[model samples]
Target: MSDIYLFYKPFHVLSQFTDERTDEESPRTTLAEYLKVPNIYPAGRLDYDSEGLLLLTDDGELQARITHPEYKLPKTYWVQVEGDITDEALTQLSTGVELKDGRTRPAKARRMDPPKVAERSTPVKPRKGKGTSWLELTIMEGRNRQVRRMTAHVGFPTLRLIRYAIGSWTLEGLKPGRWRQTTVHMPEQTQKVTLKPRKKGRGEHAGSKTTHKAHPKTAQPKSAHRTPRKPKGGR
Candidate 1:
């Protein structure tokens, strides 16, 4: 049986076991304080500055399956951007953007019309001639600071970011710093899962034994007796 948990992380909480005493204050809330289960680690991490749904699991294979890029799990975010957002900007975001590092993958984005979402506690800076707007975006890739960079590249510049969902899991009724154990059960026919072994070649053969044989009275090979050759003259 596998153990999986869904946690709603709040802003300013570090995604680590130990809190560092940096300029940013140490996290007052931690997974240990919330979750009583043992041996579970976060499937993926949410930045200390970001907030949303996070997954934890005691099964190492399940962790890799969720966090690894190959899974391409879709993550949804509600972002508030600075400046007036146009349909063109939304279209551009949906298509792709050329960031400083490289082009971002195609994403789904749409400008949210009123009734707009409630304002954030700390509102973004207001522009002189332009106004801020909200957007709903979904993307498959979770690159470092990806949503922020993508929005900035398209001239929106995300002011506030909140992840809403990861794959099938969501924050739902979970408030900040709260977590719940997920009870997932599958029938016998539905549980045919396989994991590749870590070793390779002959080493992977079942019941194969490897024994190291000691060489008796063995001399050095002929190549070891050759004299060192001089390098060709350089100009």
Candidate 2:
């Protein structure tokens, strides 16, 4: 079974487990500081500057689906931008704005109140006594810094970005650096594709479909008589 988790990643923390560049004087925080579970890795990336909901799982297939751009999972963000978000900007954002890479897909964008949640360590404030605005933006595709670039292109650069939701999962009841264990049920078709009948051997249980790999160095004993190969389309 896949061990899935919803983690609330805080600001300035890396999505990965280890920080190879860390030292006693200047330490970098990582997921290893929060998550103690073994074999569980982050399914998708949350930038070091960005904060909010992060998905982690041991299932490779589930991780692939969530991270792949082709899947088009809707990610909702509560963004604090430099200036007031106008209706015109929202319209352009919803219609699809041209980016350096290409035109972005039509997204759901609307002006919203500041989200009531845990504050960042390096707090985002209005600069030069200028007013700032909060917005709710949802996008399907995951481009590198797409949210920040989109808001900037629309004339209101983002001050702070918080990913509020990914698909149906939200950051409700989760504080910064906190995580919750959960099960994500896959489709029947996916289940069939993920699980294959395990070959029974000495001291092995029948009908088990474990995903563990065998040692490369440890080889099986060869028989004098050739054994018949099983036909394709596993039983």
Candidate 3:
């Protein structure tokens, strides 16, 4: 069976295994720091600043199903905004918000009571007068910083975003930088096979039967942790 892992990614943590930047001295943390399990990789990306549930697997098909836009798996986030979110903003989010890239799909958005979340290491900047609010937002599509952009488009800039769930997976029982494994039965794909002639023994006939077998695809998840990297300047 292919390896499947569920990880709770913390803030400032990268979803990948290595930092792509060239500056060696610049401290950038990656999944490799926490995960010693080799060959597993993140199925999709989570931004350095965002924290929440991340799925890793060695199964390429499962990865494609989770990350590919065509599958449209629902991803839910617990978002904290700069101001009290309004009904109008909720409506816009539920109806679809116009972003620079394009209009986002209508999402599930509602004001939420303060969730029992662990305190962030780097606390969100305390707004002097403007109060902060929380919202539970679910979207079917994965766009680069889409949640942040959507919230900003509707006037409430997102200060903190935590992915609460993805499809059937959640961060339940998993802590930041920790992971667990499970076996899954993924739909098998049709495969084509080519035959190769079998080697003949000394007594075997000149003509020998050939055989071949289709290889099954499997997947696994790599190491992960919550380590937020500062987003460059402008939000």
The numbered model that scores best in lDDT is 2
After TM-score superposition, what is the CA distance of residue 235 in candidate 1 from its true location, in Å?
54
Q: Write the per-residue lDDT of candidate 1 for residues 1-235, one digit (tens) a residue.
A: 3445667666666565555444465334455565666566777777766777777766555566667677677889888888878898888889988887788788999877532333444556767776778888999887778998888888888777778887756666566666666533322343222222122211222112222111121111222232222111100
User: Candidate 1 regions off by >4 Å?
Assistant: 21-29, 113-130, 185-235
- Give the per-residue lDDT digits (tens) of candidate 2, residues 79-196: 9998788999999999899999999999999999888987789978877967899999999888889999999898999989999998767777678887776654333333222233
How do the residues 1-235 of candidate 3 rate in per-residue lDDT, one tens digit apiece? 3455667788898888877777978867787777777667787888899999887776565566567676566899999999989999999999998888899988999999988888888999847998899999999988789999999999999999999888756766666776666654433453322222232222322232222222232222322432223222211
Candidate 3's error at 80, in angstroms? 0.6
Give per-residue lDDT, candidate 1, residue 212: 16
Per-model C-alpha lDDT, please? 0.63, 0.73, 0.72
Deviation from truth (RMSD, Å), model 3: 13.9
Candidates 1 and 2 compared: the better one by TM-score is 2
Q: How accurate locally is residue 132 in candidate 3, as Cα lDDT from 0 to 100?
A: 94
Query: Ranking under TM-score, best-scoring first?
Result: 3, 2, 1
TM-score of each: 0.70, 0.78, 0.78
